[model samples]
Target: MTILHVSAVKSWGGGENHIETLCYELKQSNPEIKNIVLCVENTLFHERLNETEIEFQTAPLAYNLDLRFSFKIIALCKNKKVDLIHIHDPSAIALTIIADKFASLPPFIFSKKTSFPIKNKKLTLYKYNYYKIKKYLCVSEETRRVTVESIKVKDKVITVYQGTSITNKSSETDFLLRKKFDIDESKKIVGLIGNHIRAKNLETFIETVNIIVNIKKRTDIIFVQIGSFTDRTEDLIAKVHELKLENFIHFIGYIPKASNFIPQFDALLMTSQSEGIPEVIFESFYHKKPVISTNVGGIPEILQDGINGLLTKKQDSAMLSEKIIHLFNNKELAEKFVTISYEKLITNFTASVMAQKTLKEYKNILNGN
Candidate 1:
């Protein structure tokens, strides 16, 4: 089976990482299935794919409706004889709709990696419910549920949880978090990983840190955020300074293989107002670090509050702060959470398991089941 993966995103994130993990797993487990990527030229995804053995091609995405990108899609579909086109993001879905106008492209398998409800707009609705799209692979059940409300055929939407590749799991990173930041050995590190975006709710992260450090007067715990910086970063930093949290909160902008630093963190903190189960949670599971996240999206599907991990209400700084402190203070509870998380990762949430389920769906789609 020959598959062409499409990603029009300029920056790297969980969705991009999902494509990488899926392709790598397919190559190892099912070598007969050929997977190739078509990403925006000169983008971070394009740059990262160049480092891997994965076969890929790029087209200039100068604008949303760039004909150049659609033309490249036409050429690849015909020249490569792609059996299926797996669209990774919403932008790529719109691009594919444009490409289909000029050529009879292969059947599509669109992956809905976020839980954002489909907007009630004519063009947006048409693009999402496009005729050629045979399957909608949702990252989580919550995502699938939201997607079904927008899709014409409810049966087309299926939950296929995105997972992390665990083959290279390690704690040996040269970039030591404690040493580089000059953090005291006695201090516990709480790690947050996500780009500066509205969905991530980084402002809430800052507020939670303020409550823990200033209001609560906890000096032993420090926060280290790692992700791509954006225009919102300056404002976040300003808020940190305004709250006098410069000493407690540290923003260590984008680091490649940031998950490698998971071992250094005492716990993983996610303040996302929305999500489709961020990959960092799975990474933390593999690293055996306790997690505390907002009760949004499919996070609750995996992170049962106080069982494997803790979950707080969205944007609730006081509750989030309390959970973080509670997790850190109770050593036995922390140990229990990590143990359950690690077991769950190996049993249900590994890349190998995710690939096997996805491959089954691909076969069913081709067989017209």
Candidate 2:
């Protein structure tokens, strides 16, 4: 079976990371599948593939209506005898819809990664429910439910959780954080690892810190945030400053290989408004760190209250701060939670598991089942 994976996004994030991991696993485990990645030239995904031996081709795409782009993809499919097209993002979906209209194309499989519901618009439905889109590989049950609800196509959607893989790399690279910040042993670091995007709800984390330090009068927890700040970052920083918790709050902009630094965190926190089951939670499991997340999207599916990880109502900083305090107070419970999460990670959230489930879907669709 031959498949052409298309990703035209210039920015790199979890979606791109998942694409790279799935491609790597497919090449290693299913050598006969003839996996090829088609992306924009010199982009992050393209550069990442260069580090591996996986075959990929890069072609520039400027706009959604680029007729030449459609023709190019059609030509590539014909020349390479590509069996199926797996497009990653919305932009790539538009490309495939246009390309399929112009050529005798293979089936298209859409990978849905977000929990956000589809917009109730004609164009949105038409684009997603395109004639050639044979299957939908959703990253979580929440994502699948939304996709089906929005598209009104229930039979085609399937949930497949994103798998996580961590290489036991050295933490020498992360020493720069401790050295640069001059953090001491007395500080208990509670970290939130993600971008400053709206979905991340970083203001909640900052507000939770205020509750812990100012309201609760806790002096030990040092809140550290990784990932790059975006347009909404100023408000978060100003809030932290206004609350006078700046001394305890630290922002370390984007770093490479974040998992290496995750182990240094005493606990992991996710204050997102929405998600399709974040990979960072799985990484924390592998790192043996207790996780605390808001109960939204597929987060509650993996975070079982006090069993494996603590869950709070979305946007409830009081409850979140309480969970944080509880985890710190009950060391044995936190350790047990992390251990249970690690067990779940090995049973359901590994790269091999993800790749195998995805391959099964590919084969089922390819065989016309």
- Candidate 1 Cα outliers beyond 4 Å, as residue runs: none
lDDT of 1 at 121: 99
Query: Candidate 1 residues 1-369, lDDT tens each?
Result: 999999999998998889999999999999999999999999878888998889999999999988899889999999998998999999999999899999999889999999999999999999999988999999899999999999999999999888888886767776788888899999999999999999999999999998898899999999999999999999999999999988888998877777889989999999999999899999999988999999999999989999999999999999999999998789998899999998998988999999999999889888987
Off by over 4 Å in 2: 41-43, 61-72, 166-176
The ten-residue window of minimal lDDT in model 2 covers: 166-175
Model 1: weakest 10-residue lDDT segment is: 168-177
lDDT of 1: 0.92
Clashes of 2: 0
Candidate No. with top lDDT:
1
- Backbone clash count, each prediction separately: 0, 0
- List model 2 lDDT by residue over 1-369, tens digit each: 888988877656678778877877887788888888887777666776787787888887666566666776788899899989988888888877888777778988889988988888898889998877888998888888888987656798998899886443345564655556666887778888888898889988988999999999999898889886678888888888899987889988776666668778899999999898888888898888999999888888788998999999889999999999999989898889988998999898887789898899888888897
